[model samples]
Target: MGIVLHLKKKEMACVEYSFHVPSLEELVVVLQKGLKGNFADVQVSVVDCPDLTKEPFTFPVKGICGKTRIAEVGGVPYLLPLVNKEKVYDLNKIAKEIKLPGAFILGAGAGPFQTLGFNAEFMPVIQIGSEHKPAMNGSYFAHINPADGGCLLEKYSEKYHDFGCALLANLFASEGQPGKVIEVKAKRRTGKLNFVTCMRQTLEKHYGDKPVGMGGTFVIEKGKAKTHIMPAEFSSCPLNSDEEVNKWLHFYEMRAPLVCLPVFVSKDPGFDLRLEHTHCFSHHGEGGHYHQDTTPDTVEYLGYFLPAEFLYRIDQPKETHLFGRD
Candidate 1:
């Protein structure tokens, strides 16, 4: 029988967004923003993989893209859908092949063909460097932390999908609020893109002085945290064109460290800004695969790092807040 590849239509749904911690600066920003209430708070630092060192290291390589340097590789561009094609597989085997840092081989989801008889799982891993570090964003919660009550979004896309991406854009923009007003507007100029604009006003007290492990009950699982906070309307669009793609990339590149930082909100009255790194695997998913040279030594692909303008909107406290306080 000919190979039957699984095909999944892109569904726009709400998805959780999270990232790894790269530096102490990011940590501070995340915490300060999440601990701003009148009650006591709890803070804990636990690496996803205890044995995994914070330093960067090199790993053995494979696949057709071997020519691409380690640093040049960003997140996986296309979604690795588990199609109706099957080969002998195990979650443990895949993890080993990918050389992920942690033992917990979290599975994003199963096949595009279930009844058709295809079962597979996806686990994405990255290689960090001296200048590269992991970070996270706190816009939408996937789960909760069992130990210290931290938010979680393990394999976020598995749950919410692309709409989740839009949700996060609004959530992080709001600085984490339940009723805070968020505005998402469309951009006039589009190369096949949607514009999302958001604003929020708050009067909550700063719980910066609150003690750890205090406040209301929140969902916390094994390094997973979930919050029921919705952001105001931001812009929306179908990410399908080169212009829209470039626009999004430029939007993030210019934001600098801010785009790299996590959104922080406290059950407390006070606010503390903590910065964290997030991963975006949303790569160019258009053309079909080209199965060319089997011999790696026969081909060479050029590599380039395109740098562009950085533009990030600064949310002023006195302006977007209820009582003119940040």
Candidate 2:
């Protein structure tokens, strides 16, 4: 519903003579002018964190797609329902109701902490903890009481390198075949300092087979220099081959701001790219309308720019940095 476009310093300067138009088609047209004639490689990166859960679906009781306020624990609101006298919980059935084939679900804890993915469009779900615990407010997932687990989910995210592995398992259950998996590991020698290494060989396997593009996310732990990379990886073909690996991390640099903008492939194609500056969480209105009746303002864009090295490291810096300067 929203998108932010940021052009790195070098890329912005390369297109000094061109202009940015509001529509996606316009952007393509402007870009084509510079894209011609032995031009260096230009890559575009996009990260999508949708406000899949709307109003009424906030809590798990009504349905998996709406919002609700559950009972509180330790003076904090945890999005979990108390085991009623009948001891009935309809969350799983609710998930079945909204499941869509080939749907990708992403979740986080202590903040959008727990996420489940199935190749289907179903109620956005987040499950937390064993039982009988307090919940803490989470940013990316549902809010939980801190007393419930003392931010254990955040710790898991840090440790496993893939925060919501359980959710990924849930998502994989839909296909019956595991999709591409990449794991990054770190050793905490100095207070959450991260030294990351890719554990999945398939991560770099897809390089030139598919048309290269960019999508993924990057977050620096509150104050740590160590950065966690969430690359936007997808495939028209189910397998993760060597053809398109680089596309996922393609144009990571340029550190452009994520802003809401219209993306048009041609005069006839367009869609809204949501951008969040502060946090990657937002709730949508009844009918795909963003920023409606949600508290803490739904972020349209996550931030500006992918890491500069992500872009420069790929191939061409001038081509990717086009509109806004970093």
Candidate 3:
């Protein structure tokens, strides 16, 4: 008798877009439209948006994302989905006796895949060094301090090496400080190296923040906090071609201290990854398997390099997630 192999498709993570209705009367219309579009289990809730002018953060609305301050309006519901906010997961849970006022929000979350795809096509610009720390555009809620309501994203500074909260100052309007810093424990999966899974695992340590998508140029997980010497020749270095770029990077590998490699991703699953270290190139998936000799900086198979125009901050990847806010 032949053996029947019953195969089950893997339940890969999925993301989708959310919608906004102007009034309670529009809820049914939106829900009917969504169901027609094949979306299931439509849910609704109330949320209040902060007045950026009044609430204090260099960027106030950014302090709240994902985890909504769910509110109810006259027995109706709404939601403020800030998919753009940087989140560490945990948002303060308002007391049961408390209630929120109705706020305006047009749309909800989109598959980070869709979101990042949009970013790659339209907005691929990123900054080097802490000058504006453009990589950190997410809301400050990810770095909120539980003890004192401190937010770290508002205070990262390259000058004092304050890295947001290098001064260990208050993040929120409270008086308490971070109770203590504790390192999160990590365990690697056996066999194949899964970069996305690994990154997601580390981020899971934080209560509220989770990755929706990655595109263009980004750092998944900061490898080290220490900065290595950037070659003086780097200023004049041209990353014009793979060959030229490889030589410049080779100069660092043999002498310079270890630096963080900025990773790039594409929508295509095949050539979806790139690691531009000592001559990096695109890989099939997750930069392929981590070979015994494979180093963090090398993303390509042939060891080619990317030109300088594509290079991100070569100084050091942003290791500190949240810093003390002013």
Candidate 4:
């Protein structure tokens, strides 16, 4: 059993900080120093799209931009036989696999025009009137798709807020609970906005309750001795009580680039959700390592849902211009 940390009720101040790349030492210092009071933790935030530019490849190495393509769900690739509705299209079974006792499934749909990106071989039947016939491609989850779908998935993530509801709806549906899932109604065009707060509340609406008692994910030990506290990596815990939610959010706000949303994994209500950033645990030979400064520079901010605020008053000034006139 994991050690239980209680989330206590507390008020907080609104706070926000912005900066660019700094030396590793400076980055660590800035990150570590930011810890105190309401700042229990911090996460690195991406300012823009990640650098994926590449030269014409002769041979690809194993790393962030690897050559091999693997689209998996529960160790099963979507591109393989599993893609067939007749063979692997069992929604209830997939729901059982998720182990969510009282799952709230949503179906995110789209018009024919919206299904254009799936212009590839896998979805051979995904052209005009595609929206009329709801296939698994655009209607369900888009992640781990062939080129057309994968490209759309990446673009959707850039404005994830627009598709927040849809993402969750399809995400759950893709996992088998295709029915009863929720979808965000508004349309999104560019990367200028987000709906993280709304999405969090939606998750809570369907999953949270007074019985769960707040708790999200606690740190898992790693490396030889596992001494490091794990820096700027994404992780989550959907705490039970109001206090737990606030505490966990605070823990990440000051420490790394994190965005917390209400998530319901099982009806047990007591299931303490543990979140591990996929990238944090993924790597080829080296095995999932992150640069202290650069990793964060690529992530665009996902509007956070925090109970309290930490608005710093710099009008009076401090030691630096950040506070006002030094």
117-216 per-residue lDDT for model 2 (tens digits): 2111111233332133221112232122235411111222322222222111111111111222111111212211111111011111222121111112
- Clash count list over all predictions: 68, 84, 29, 33
Candidate 1 lDDT tens digits, 78-177: 2111111322223222222223221121112222222212221111222221123221211112222346433223332334222111101101111011
**In model 1, what is the error at residue 266, expressed in angstroms?**
20
Q: Which stretches of candidate 2 lie over 4 Å from their true place?
A: 1-43, 46-94, 101-104, 109-217, 221-326
Better of 1 and 4 by lDDT: 4
**Candidate 1: worst-modelled 10 consecutive residues by lDDT:** 194-203
What C-alpha lDDT values do all the predictions have? 0.18, 0.19, 0.18, 0.19
* lDDT, candidate 4, 1-326, per-residue tens: 12222223531111121111123333223322322111223342222212211121100111111110111121111112112121122223323323322222222211111232321111100111122322221211222233322211222222222221200011111111111111121212122212222222333433344211110111111211000111111124322343432332211111222111121121122221111111111111111111121222232322211111111111111111111000
What does candidate 4 score on TM? Answer: 0.20
Give the per-residue Cα lDDT of candidate 1 at 313.
15
Stretches off by above 4 angstroms in model 1 are 1-29, 34-89, 100-102, 111-326
In lDDT terms, how accurate is model 2?
0.19
Candidate 4: regions farther than 4 A off = 1-73, 76-87, 96-102, 105-298, 303-326
Worst 10 residues of 3 by lDDT: 72-81
lDDT of 3 by residue, 84-151 (tens): 22211111111111111111111111111222221100010111122222222222111223365321
